[model samples]
Target: MQTDPTKDIGSVFGRSWTLLSSNWIIIVPAIIIGIIAGLIAALVTPTYYMDTSGVYPVPVYHSMLGLSLVVGTMIATFVGMLANVVILTMTTGMAAAAWKTGKAMISDGMDALRRPNVLSAMLMLIVVSLVLSLLTLVTLGLAGLISLVVFFFLIYTIAAAVVGGFSGMDALKESFEVAKTSWLTTLIVVVLLGVVAFLATLLAAAFHFVPFIGPIIAAAISGVIVAFFSLVLVGEYNDLRGRAHPAVAAQPPFTAPPAVPPL
Candidate 1:
């Protein structure tokens, strides 16, 4: 089916606004889930700084040192790749659950945690993340941009699969098909949303800079924005599947106003 990029964008944004206006109750649970997940990620992952020292010596020594460095780097790279797989798998499972409920935030996060397939889905995510990360690393940073593209595709696919009651592979395939049909438009929408998110973050940061009540307000704003995005994504998925959103359908048709009677 032909996809109308503009329509999809409109549907997503419209539904997002509607969700914010009327379904805020759902946002609370989702935000709680995000907070828990964020805390876990921050606590579990150790912060490490890489310190590199340069040595200048004879050609032979330099060559040997270079080979050693390369070998060590490769080994470390493989380990990092494995870690990425684990992280992505877990996050993807959470994302899938969120998508299934059409709430964007982790409304179903606890229930999703009870599912047997969540683990397997997370494993798949880890594998995909590792592969993408390695590719990006190999390309001297150009691959990073591609990785972002892949990340979004993967996220939508995982969410669709979970929501559509399909396997991870099937979901990934469908996402690719959708992306292929309207890649440029999809990219544009994503970029625009990202810019909006960045601005929101900046504004939140300004609030956070206040001496008191700053952090609390910033967190609240961030949570609201996250909720907004989640609903929008759900709406976008529905639109892609040909579902007619009430808001979109209810939009008043263009009409000319009646001419006033001459007085």
Candidate 2:
């Protein structure tokens, strides 16, 4: 058992690629999802550029202070926080759906998509992301780390919600319980993934000097990398869930202990 969370980074990366390849039909739809997201993002470029300077105030501080400096700072902080919440929520939901869809393709072929539970899982994912984002803000960003710990658990919960027919919040709570068993591993994975994502963005920016083609290429590459990493994180979440919870093991059938000889 690898104690270091970072140690599993490579393994997760390899597994993600393998999973994607093995379930290409499902993976293809995931890529399509990415492309659609990217297209929407692209379409909003002008609006984003125009609103770059706009900011919203932080709810609490904004109401308390009337000073110009304080107001400006609060506004910027609020906008930044809100934007992050929205973007993360969208991506997380998409990633959760993609992972569940991929697994379904591998296990039950195309028929898996027909299940109503699948749509429910995707819907619940968006809600979870929103809840997590607000939770992070309430904790003054401390929940960022907590978010990492529950990262995979959330995905697994989404899968369970879809497959086992669990309620969204119930599945989320179950994931948190399972994640607690391997919190350290989860932390390391989160840090390493964060580093990789940052570096990928930096590299993508290097393409900006190429005139007309640069920005487009950069956007496409960055989008793909983002999509790939999102899937990897979700895959890792699935792996961790099985490892942390014996009842959810993928191998031999898990049997419940006989009801303790009635009291």
* Residue 261's lDDT in candidate 1: 100
User: Which 10 residues in a row give candidate 2 its minimum summed lDDT?
Assistant: 44-53
Name the lDDT value of residue 39 in candidate 2: 57
**Model 1 residue pairs with clashes:** 30-106, 85-126, 89-122, 89-126
Model 1 lDDT tens row, 112-231 = 444545444545666676677677678777788788777666545544544444455665765665556556555766787798789989998999779888976776776666556655
**Scored by CA lDDT, what does every candidate get?**
0.56, 0.55
Name the top lDDT candidate: 1
Can you give the TM-score per candidate against the true fold?
A: 0.60, 0.53
Q: Cα RMSD (Å) per model?
A: 12.8, 10.1
What's the C-alpha lDDT at position 54 in model 1?
A: 39
